[model samples]
Every structure is written in C-alpha cells, then in structure tokens.
Target: MPRVGGTKNVDVAAVIALRPDLVLANKEESSQRDVERLIEAGLPVFVSFPCTVEESLDYVETLARLLHVDAPPRPAPARRQGELRVCAPIWKDPWMTMDGRTYGSDLLSWLGADNVFSDRARRYPLAADVAGAPAADPGARDTRYPRVTAEEIRARGPALVLLPDEPYRFDETHLEEVRSWGVEAALVSGKDLFWYGVRTAGALERLDRALAPHR
Candidate 1:
C-alpha cells in the first residue's frame, strides 16, 4: 500500500526500499514529476485528484476496487435540477477547473441553472478576466445573464445572484455593493454548490425550498 505523508516531500529512499505492491497519490500534491521519479525508481503508482466530497466517495470505490474489496452500496440518483434562472459568478482565477467528476458545475447543470462554460471537467474556472465571469452569448437559447454591473452593485440586476463565501468571503457589504447595481441577490454556501456526501440529494431539497419560486 501507499503512504500518506504529512508533509509534501516524501522520503522516497525509505518508501522505495520497502518494496510496496502499489502506491496512491493526490494529483495536486504528488506532482507528475514526483510520480515519474518514483516510476523511474520502479514503483507502480496511481494518482487521484479528488477536490470535492463526491470525488472522495469515488476514491473510496476506486481504492476498494484496486484492493479487490466490495464497494459500498450504490446510492439513489441525486434530485433533479430545479427549474429556475440562476446566474452564478463563482469564477476563480487561473481556473481551478473543476474535474469532470467534481460537484459544483454538476450541481448547476443538474439543477437546470444554465451553465456558461463546458470545458470538459465540471469545475469552477479561475478566470482572470472579470468580463469572463459575466459573459454569455446574448443569442443563446437557454442561457441568461444576471443583471450585473462591473460599474457598481447598486446599478446591477438579477432575480437572484448567488455570491459565494468561498475562495473569498463575500460579505454583506459586498452584497450591498452588488445590490447597488440594482440587483437583489443572496449569498450562497460555496460548499453547497460543490460538496455533497450523504446529503447530496437532501441538499437539493434545501435548495428548492430556499431558492425556487413559491408558485
């Protein structure tokens, strides 16, 4: 089995000397160069890039499969995406680029919130351009833009703009700034859009109850 080191750099000399059957590593932490070095030293390695809670579940199954162990029970499908118009501005710069297997974009697509980009992985991108965050084809059939103003929040508009509290904490003052753009919006839990374990389906219930129209 592979080892989980508390630190970033590992003592490869000690690990390789043990002659383990298999090794696992995180993609972000265990760089390709590091794994390549291990392979050059004659160790078989598997890398994981689990960022969200769902990927954590998948990693468990992958580990079990590799170990010839029975997987945990299959869960019921997650709830349907709610019917609503949602404009999300949760862009991260340098493109954190959610894995296709991640949760955030999946939630948006599943909930029928009209996603903006389709760059393979269902992840939030760290977009450097503020314009990128607000961009969508004006003639696009399904997509809609939230009434927003880079100029000022008081001048902005949106039925419900979800300001996230992650990557950076968007507070009341920030909300007021966005509201100043002539849009009334709510601050949503970033984790809710991204993380889901046992509550994956239940979270949908909460979102519908909280966000959808009363009709």
Candidate 2:
C-alpha cells in the first residue's frame, strides 16, 4: 500500500475505472508528480495543504465537511481516536524540528508517542541546541552545536525516534548506528504522516505495526 508504487499505484487505476463520486487528497501529503498527473487526467480531485498546528485541526474540520461526516460525534469525540506524537528530526548534523505549525509536527500528532522535544526551549532548533552538545557545558559549546550526537540521544531518550525517510532519508546505516547507542529509531512515510485523514486510520495502524520491531 505504499504511495509510490505497487498496489497503491494500481489503486489509482482501479478507482478511475469505477468513476467514484469524489477524490480527496492533501496537497502536502500526496506525491507532487502523482497528484499532478491525476489532475491532468481530468479527475475530480480536491487538494488541501494542512501544514501547521492550527491548520491541521482545520484540515480535519474541512475534510469532514467535504465528506459529509461533520456531524457531532456522540458526546466524546476525543476518546474515539488515538493520537501519536511524532518526532521528526529536521536538522543537518545536529538534527532539528519544526514549530507546532509545520507539516512534520502534524504527522507526529498521530504517530502516537509522546514527543520528548515538545517542552524544549526552542522550536525547530538544533538537537545539540536544545539537549546540549553531548557532554558540553551549558554556558558554552552546547549553545552552538550544529548536529545531533549519541550523547544528545542518550540524554533525551525519546520513547521512539521516527525519522523522515525522505528530504533527509534516514537509512539502514543510520538505523544501525542508532541501535548501537541503545536508542530505538526508524524511518516513516513523510507523506502518510503529513497527509493523513479519516480514510487513513488503517494506514496509521499499519505504520504502528511497521515500527513495532524498533519498539
């Protein structure tokens, strides 16, 4: 069910054959090329980009309205669904993250783990900047770190480290290194995390199983 190829790719063709009533997708969530091609094919496609803390909520409200499922959930809507607190390291050497308003933050919102960095002083700051440079003194080198290191990971000790598999592309080599340090880590879909909807709940659960090994 990967977005790029195989069954998921074939899904587009199948859906086209049936001439469904509507097609919904997030601008930031779907592959740019694929979405573009679908549009070129004259499909009735609707796209939106939810890229922030506020915008993400707005996305849900808007999407629900589009699908005619916006009726008030019976009394307690919050308890009906679970959420993940994804931690997307977006920096270079030291690693960093975006604000509560970025697409990465939105993805982690449903990744289901508590984000260890949520309380950090700076938003989207270098790993060394927030956690300190390994063992450096608080008043000096820690303030100017340019990359994340083993010491930082050991100290922060996030419940699960979900790195992006694209843009930065954390691979097996990175996984091997992270495992060696006693920290659990894995790569997740940048799109799925960034572009989830009610239809994607199953996909998220699948993602949870995919990362179960690292847990």
Candidate 3:
C-alpha cells in the first residue's frame, strides 16, 4: 500500500505513476479537481458519496464488484427501544452539526437516536447560519451541515451531546464545555461517525453502545 496524498491534496503524478487498476475516492473527502485529473489521465476512478447506512452498504457491494472481491456480510445493527435526543457537533468556532440529510444523522437515527438539529440546514454567506443575519434560501445552497450557536443548542434540549474528534477534534475540554450547556456529553470516535463502507456495521454497533446508557 502506498500513500498517494491527503484527501484534499492528492499527488496526481504519483498516482498516475503507480498505474493502478482503479482509484477510489469520496465525493466529500477527496477534491473534485483531483478526481477529474485522474480521469483525464485515463485512470479508472470510483467516487462514492453514500448519505445513509443502507447506501453505504450498497457502496461496499458496488466496490466489491468493481474489484472482483466478495463484499463482507452486513452486520445487524442493534436498535434501542426508546429514542435519545442527540446533537453531534462536528466543528466549533461557529459550531456546526450534521442535519438529517447527512449519512451521520441517518446512522444515528438507525440506532434509535433523534438528531436535535435534523430539520436545520446550513445557510449561505456562512454568517447567515448564526444569528443576526437574514436566512438563506434553502433551494439556492447546500444545507447538510448547519452552523449552530450554543444558545440554540441549549434550546434544542438534547439529552446527549456527542462530540466527535474529526473535522474539529472535540476533546475532554470540549466535552466539559458541552456538558455545561445542561446536557450529557461524550467524546466519540469521529471515524465511527463519519467514515462509511466496510466499517459501517461496526461503526453503528460502536455508536449504539456509546449511546446505550444515555437511552
């Protein structure tokens, strides 16, 4: 296994030099320009962007077919009886969280947790996401990750605030801060929450266990 480059800044020349059979990429993680470059170089590339747990499993099956490999059997997700109100913040500094449209939110939903901001969507002009700005038209912009405020989160009244360590690296310090908002908070693995494909089943199980006590 060789390192072509980071998600955003892939080394196109290095990848082309490898002369591999196929290049795998994620629409959200990898840069569009890089994927285009690989295609322009006559390299076969498979770009995936699954927005739900079911879709992720489908992606795994598709990838397996492309590579002539057997797709691992999907794991059974443990669903709880009652729903736990959850707000998972991916980033701070104008705090942002995933809405219902995202894979993360759907994953949580499958585990019997309700996303507090599931109906909220990101507003354009960035500043419009927070207070004191006019709302952006939902039809005109991407609205999966919405920027939120501490006050707004408090108002949503989530029973558990899940803080992931990627996209923003929320740690113990952040956990304490979130708890201060009058809610139970925990630091969970970002990869489990965001990463899809072969790990989807395990991620769901891990996250379900993490949210079990809260439920």
Candidate 1, residues 1-215: lDDT per residue as tens digits? 55645336777767688877787776555656768878888988878765444565677678778878897764554546444444455542222223223355566555555433333222112231223454334452222112222542222222555667774567797679657766666777766765544455555555555566521
Winner by lDDT between candidate 3 and candidate 2: 3
For candidate 2, the 10 contiguous residues with the lowest summed lDDT are: 71-80
lDDT of 3 by residue, 44-105 (tens): 99999999988999999999999999888866665555678899999899899999999999
- Per model, how many backbone clashes are there? 19, 15, 0
Best first by lDDT, ranked: 3, 2, 1
Model 3 TM-score is 0.94
Q: Give model 2's TM-score versus the native structure.
A: 0.48
Error of 1 at 66 (Å): 3.2
- Candidate with the greatest TM-score versus the true structure: 3
Off by over 4 Å in 3: 136-141
With candidate 1 superimposed using the best TM-score fit, by how many Å does residue 183's alpha carbon deviate from the native? 2.7
**Residue 145 CA error for candidate 1 (Å)?**
17
Ranking by TM-score: 3, 1, 2
Global lDDT of each candidate: 0.54, 0.54, 0.89
